[model samples]
Target chain A: MHIPDGFINVPTVVVTSAVSAGAIAYGVSRANRRLGEKHVPLMGVMAAFIFAAQMLNFPVAGGTSGHVLGAALAAILLGPWVGVLIMACVFIVQCLIFQDGGLTALGANILNMGIIACFVGYYLYQGVVSFWGERRRSQLVAAFLGAWLSIVAAAAATAIELAVSGTSPLAVALPAMAGVHVLIGIGEGLVTAAVISLVMTTRADLLQLERV
Target chain B: MRYSFLDQFSDLDSFIHRLDPRTKLVSCLAFILAIVLTPPGRWQVFLGYFSLLLILIIISKVPVFYVLKRSLVILPFVVLVSLFIPFFKEGEVAGSYNLWLWQVSVTYTGLAILGNVVTKAWLCVLGLILLSATTGITDLLKGLEGLGIPRVIVLILSFMYRYIFVVVDEAMWMRQAWHSRSFGNKGLRQIKTLGNIIGSLFVRSYERGERVYVAMLARGFDGKVRTLHSLTFRKADFYCGGLWFILLVVTGVFLW
Candidate 1:
């Protein structure tokens, strides 16, 4: 899911860089207001956790390995603004220190994995949980759908980036990426659900925040 | 649950590690752009790129073996996909083979593409290892926030970092439980036990998420999220960042 540098082309980087920049600016402003004093260091630690998890990829089909995205988990646990910020931090570190993703494609990766996954996944999770009465079972379903959609959304966004960069024809990149990613999404959903369940049981108090 | 793996190298004072996360982030991005944008046939440029990253790796003081091992983890996936290129990539056939009724051909062009993919990917990974080894993950996220990264993504990363150790601990405990109940990996029943362990892990994680959420809310988490501090830019950040960016551009232009 972390597209290394040069996978997409030049023009796509330009566009995505701008879009990602805009989103980050807004997310930071929002997070400033929402986060309490304690959240500063806490968020930093949480960011570190996502970085580690992303590094832990389990083998999946089609010769690719998938890992937890942590988007839905972030948003449902810490609110959407913080969720997006956490992913941005992970993307930046992965590129600079770990090189898991491309520098030029940072914007694209943020948009795909950061924006789409965190914000989109959080809202969807909230919607489902609220709709189903916000019980334990509802939380599981919300985590599933939220995690599943984030992966698929990221796949769609990457396909568009490939198309814009003119890497392979859209005809090739779109379906190929989505097809493989759908299988990947199943893994993401399960992992997200597991993490959410773990937090729910040990510190159910922490999750009560989502309900409020 | 020890989770020091991410920042273990961050505290070692070094020049490369001292640069602002945003600066290093951009430089690496440019390096990747240069590699990915180069024509596939430019084998020399790939060599040049590899040498460049290798030089940085040495300067950063991270162990050669560690970087090599980390980068190699990506090889399996790359090889899995690229291996088939010789058979599927459309071009002049290098050779024909038969397995009973089935016939297939391998093409030189496909092999070239495979080589191209592997080299580019490897070069990119080397650069990342240098970055990860030099910067603490926490500082890196702050730098990202300073550079206008969205809050939600940053939040997601934060939780993942804090809890990965906990998750690993849980896994360890589950393994111990299984080991205690069984004599060894001696039978098919062990496999079933493993499956049960995985299933229970999933359920446990799902429940844990709720508790974390409640903890967050107790701290006054409105739907809106906020951060407590900021990443301040320093003079070294500018000079080092500018120098690296210029060098990358110069090298990339020459490659072009």
Candidate 2:
């Protein structure tokens, strides 16, 4: 999902980088509009929380552990733009100081993990919850679907990027990436659902703020 | 309920750790680009790149032991995916072996490819560990927002970050509770207990999400995102970001 440097072709890197940059720039501006002065501190605290949570790796079938991408989780909690920003920060820091992702490909990484995951996951979640007609079970279903689709959507988006860049054949890129991620999405849904539930049961009030 | 895992190392004071995330992000991007752009099989360039990474790791003040441990964690995953590469990566035969009524062959190309994959992955992870360790999650979010990430995405991540520890704690508590109530040989019974716990956890998480949404609605969250930009770039941001890119270019152009 991180999409390191070498695997992708040069043209894809350049184009995705440009597109990613535009999206991130737009995201920050949008975040600025949404978050007020008071909400900043709260948002910061939550950001820290997400960073920490991402470290906990849930075991997968092949003995490889996959951690939560947290795009959907952030969307459900803070809203999507902020969620993208949060991940962007994490990825940025990871790339610069840690070199977890390629710098030239930063655009693609953010677009895939931050923008697509955050927005897609949240709307799906919000919609599913809304459709369930105020049922608690509806939230779970929405969360499950939102999370599952968010991951797949990100995979699909990456496949498109890979195709555009001609990094790998789309047929190979789409299924290969999506297939493994689909399995990973299961963990994503479960973890996302579990976290949202804990927050609601405990300090549920904090999940919302009075918008002026 | 709060946990940043190994990323908590960012708490330490260091010049590299304090630099803006964009600077760091761009610099690392440059580093990775340089590495990837370089054609494989240049052993010296790889060595230089590794050395460069080592220097950054040292400057970041992350415990070498911890970094090694963290890097090793990914080794298993990488090995699993790439293990087949060596077996299936047809090339000039380096060695052949017969065992268990099957003949196995090793190729130099396979070995080379395996090394390439492993090295690239290691360098990438090294960069991530440094970035995560030096920068606080909160500030990192601000940096990303400032850099042009989408808000809807930001919100989703913020929630995940906030509630992840809480969720894990819940699981731990539930496990403890399960242990206290049951007193049988730990096998299928334990598995069954685990299943029950997961089901219950799922229910609770679902309920919480609803309450959270209701809370969201109460706060004027109309399925729309809003926020103010707080991460104003300082002079240091420019200095570092610029210097890093320059360094990356130099390395890419000269070394490779």
Candidate 3:
């Protein structure tokens, strides 16, 4: 869901860019608290790992393939602050280095894929896992639902932005974006659950931050 | 990950490559803003935008075909998002189709808007591709930092660029191992193995993070990250940036 330039109007870009910058600033301070002297390398490495993992495509349904969005996975593995940082880094690299997204739309992309996905996914997972009791099974279910909902939420936000910009009317853009993302979310859910379950089974120690 | 995939042509010597990355970055942002602000159905303006980009592509020495092919990658996504607008938007009916128990009408106005959105998106992508194709990621990150983006964000981006390929190589090795062990099974079983692969990759990455930290410490890395500033704005940057700005303003004014 990398929204290209011209997908949203100039006013929308300005507003979202301001909001995104504020959110990122808050996330940075929060992340700084957790990132001590020793944690710097881990933070950097984790960001790189997320970037690398995104390049790995998995078979979804039919012959189609989907890559991990890694927002929920990052939040579950690291704290939400670090999760936001990682996603933001990935987005910046994609925009500047790869041209996968537009520079003018960077803040919007960060807000949608980084902030929205990371925060929403993290909180929803906490809520679900708490309700279900923190077992392996509960964590897996929570991961699946959290990942799926995060995609839906980001997609919906993108739709709203498009509508607000008058790029497309709400009636037309909302359902269209929401519909496509619902399917994408299924893949997101499955990958999220599978990775979490596998980690829980194999190297549970690596999920030390999940408790935080 | 193909590490060079993003900036494969960045090292090539050209006027565009030689300019300060900050200038290129700002000009790119300006170009996109101009494209977005242009009113719909101004076909002349769109042509002007495209022609301007074509000239830049020539000056940059990036192959026209490479840019064209790269720009097309955004079309499927553009189409997917905008295709239904023609059906749902109400206007003078261009065509009507009866399906099952309902009728759907396409509007001329909607089609025109759709075309405008696609064209605008394509032009914006071209600008982005040009910016990325000529500038290295490290320089771009430095440019971003110089432009007053927070240091923390810049540091994170630099780390991402430096180590992304190493992690990708690890992933490729794991996938190779998986393929060697398993074959002809494209079903549920493969997904489970895929999960195992991802889990293992994460574990390895986490451990490597610790090792990398140790190595940094050994090399006298403090908690604070620092980089030597190597970028300087030359007179050529001003000349090129001024010329581009004037072109954008001239094209923009011709519209009214």
Model 1 lDDT per residue over A87-197, tens place: 777776666655666666688888898888887788899889879986888898888889888888888787777556543446655677778768778777776776676
TM-score of each: 0.67, 0.62, 0.95
Better of 1 and 2 by lDDT: 1
lDDT (Cα atoms) of all candidates against the true structure: 0.68, 0.65, 0.82
Q: Which residue runs of candidate 3 sit more than 4 Å off their true CA positions?
A: A210-212, B1-3
| Alpha-carbon runs more than 4 Å astray in model 2 | A56-67, A93-105, A130-132, A158-169, A195-212, B1-30, B51-70, B73-117, B124-256
lDDT for B208 in candidate 2 is: 58
- Model 3's chain B yields a TM-score of 0.93
In Å, residue A35's CA in model 3 sits off its true spot by: 1.7
TM-score result, candidate 3: 0.95
- Worst 10-residue lDDT window, candidate 1 chain A: A35-44
Ranking by TM-score: 3, 1, 2
Docking class of 1: incorrect
Put down candidate 3 lDDT per residue, A9-39, tens digits, no spaces. Answer: 8888898889888887887777666666655
Going through the candidates in order, state the TM-score of chain A alone for each one: 0.90, 0.90, 0.94
Give me the candidate number with maximum lDDT. 3
